[model samples]
Target: MSILLKASDLKTPMSASDLFSRTGPLVFEVGFGDGRYLEHLASANPEWNLVGAEVSLGSVWRAYRRMNRSGIREVRLFKGNARFLVRDVFEEGSLDRVFVNFPDPWPRKKHLKNRLLQVPFFQILSSRLKPGGSLFLTTDHPEYFEFSVQQGQESLCFDVIQGPPPPATLETKYARKWRDQQKPIFHAEFRCHTVIPSAPRPISSIEMQHATLKGSLENVGPFTKQVRRFEGGHAFVMEAYRELDSQGLLFKVISEEQDFRQELLIQAWPKKDGVYVSLQPFGDPMTTKGVREAVLAVTDWLVSQGLELDQTWV
Candidate 1:
């Protein structure tokens, strides 16, 4: 199977060359639907390292299987929001090229802000590209196409160049479908002419610390559905699991801020002093306010379950 990168494996603002283990031109595909174009690019350019960000787990799995079968080792797949990966994970000016084929138009009037080709997105994307690097976009939706063009022009960071879609891009399922339906595909290249300052990402990391409590440990079992609200966001504990043969309990949690959300795991295990609680390392979650609230939520839940609080460094 092809190696897949989990969010936990990435450092904030990672080095693309180091991740690929080679220095070469780096390319990113925002929504590599069906993975056809991604595979084609990897095969066509052996000297280029490719990275893809996809939100759908099913799509990611299918793409991974295809890459493994094709023996394509120069590609990495990130399963999450492309914006998060681009804005938080990749270093500034680390990319040579970026591709977006048939992204969701969010056609409804109320949903326009959800479209990917907005002005803010253009500004952020431009900051990630090296000098002269370009963003290639192809979409079948006429309205989204025009919208993207207007946003690119307004951003002032890219010199928009109307162009034909790249050959590999045409291999994507959406591109072929649109072609068969006689829909004219709109293509535009946004060449970075000026450097745009990187925006600060609303993410932070915290040192995971253990807590001690003195109480009846036997009552500290699995918890049911519970929710907690914090200053910036809220957290919900969906379920809890007990580690066999150990006094460790793992809580599956969902934490959400206005613009970001993550599924995390928090653990409460027995220590010599008492019960230790902290965010689990397995999920590789970015430390955000919501995440901190999640840790606190779990700790507070334990206290509610009759566990006496001794000392906490969560």
Candidate 2:
């Protein structure tokens, strides 16, 4: 059911506050890194309500902890990307300020498309902002800084702010790391026009990730492998890192006899890592042979890749 947008309660919140209560306008911080800047901003401006959005559970927990530790109680935190959630839930003209600081640069040319400051995103943001609301942004990478400034300058309603957002009492992990690396920081601000351009694309189904994993799974894994509980998930999952050598191989498989929910993620920890294996989120479980063949096909492929028969060490 495509329920229309509404602010303050985007998805379920760890902490919820009436974002705009006529008492004070709300401020939103997208990609609120480690929640440090979020706490600083909220504490500094106690009158303006703050809403922090992040995709990582760790960051969400850190933000919650920061709020508790600082004894600051006037903020809301959400755990998801701001793209889809923002449009569907954030009410128009409800925000006074929105901050984006040092998002992933996605350095590869193909990956540059992954940036947040796209035509579609700016369109959605324009609608979310109050008439004169400001969007603040900062970046440490010179290329990204320039890209953001250019993107903001060309955006439909945005006018690149000449100066940086106000300094805060803290720096996020990346901010601190960049500072240590002695990288220069760039800053900019933008405001949407009275009537901004409409969004270029509609909201997409959640099946994107499911499809991504599906495409990768068919071509991933060691032909022969064994299952092991994943690190944080405590179940088979995808993650970073490479293998040491071609001594052994690991395989993770999951079968849930329930609905078509994306409840599984398989991975391999080969003594030798080639390309990272991406596994299907859901596999057909109506027949035992179907499951076994799916498993063996992946394993046989790995065996063909020269994996040691005795991979039990993995």
Candidate 3:
């Protein structure tokens, strides 16, 4: 199998045992840039199964190439938010160690929310890690290091310890740059003291959603933007486009919830009887309430244009 894995390759709340061919210790690295460290880990511990998550497509490609060149087979890489993998996937207590090296500090006060090391994330990590599992983080930013330590403590799930980073960490690309610049490197180990309850907050319970309307698609033009607010989240229909080849319209929508956001497309195509409105599965969108609301927002917008709601499935 290819070392690189798409989001659809694994299910929500996936099992570590299912990821690897043989059972072994599970090591995860978040933001694995260039895949050097993960390569080192896999080489050094041949029995260990390594799983990495990276959001940057360039980084993922580079890592995949490096792994392929090294003939590494025990590593699986995911391209997406690490928070989603840790919180929604990776069965409870399946992780043995999580490495975070030189992650973006998001130094600006206004951008603090974008920083990955937050209290809620720590809590999620606590629940995912085994009894002795720990989060090892290394960074050159003093403010971010302190912020991470404080967040770990605030989660009340770990006993934080300041210490020297592993020797392998200094060999990474960013680590070498920081060392060359004579920047101070800080390392910490957030040892798990408590395992929070295993709760996977899935986006939605249903797999798919759709609606049928009793209206004509004729003159359903000049689509206006719409927004729908529901409990815990909101959906915004930013823009709509008409498909020239067929009598269909595509609406670009964004759905937002705490710590999760998705951009999706809702499609409205004419049927033999009426109009059909459903979420397009282009991005493998999770059917969250916000997403459902997005479909409703599009339907309501059509309703405003004189479409009657005949049947509902959302």
Best by lDDT: 3
lDDT of 2 by residue, 241-311 (tens): 23356422234444221111122333344323332333443432222222333344344454454532332
Runs off by more than 4 Å, candidate 2: 1-22, 197-314
lDDT of 3 by residue, 1-314 (tens): 46777544556677876788789999999999999999999999999899999888899999999999999999999887888788877888889999999999999999999999999899888888988799999999999999999999999999999999889999999999999999999999999998778676665645567888988887886866788888878899999988999989999999876545678999999999999999988977666777788889898999989999887787
Instruction: Record all residue pairs in model 1 with backbone atoms less than 3 Å apart, i.e. clashing.
Output: none
Q: Which stretches of candidate 1 lie over 4 Å from their true place?
A: 199-203, 217-224, 227-234, 242-248, 256-261, 271-273, 281-291
- Please tell me which model should have the higher lDDT, number 2 or number 3: 3
The whole-model lDDT of each prediction reads 0.82, 0.55, 0.87
Point out the worst 10-residue segment of candidate 2 by lDDT.
207-216
* TM-score per model over all chains: 0.88, 0.58, 0.88
Report the poorest 10 consecutive residues by lDDT, candidate 3: 1-10
Native RMSD of candidate 1 (Å): 2.8
lDDT accuracy of residue 168 in candidate 1 = 71
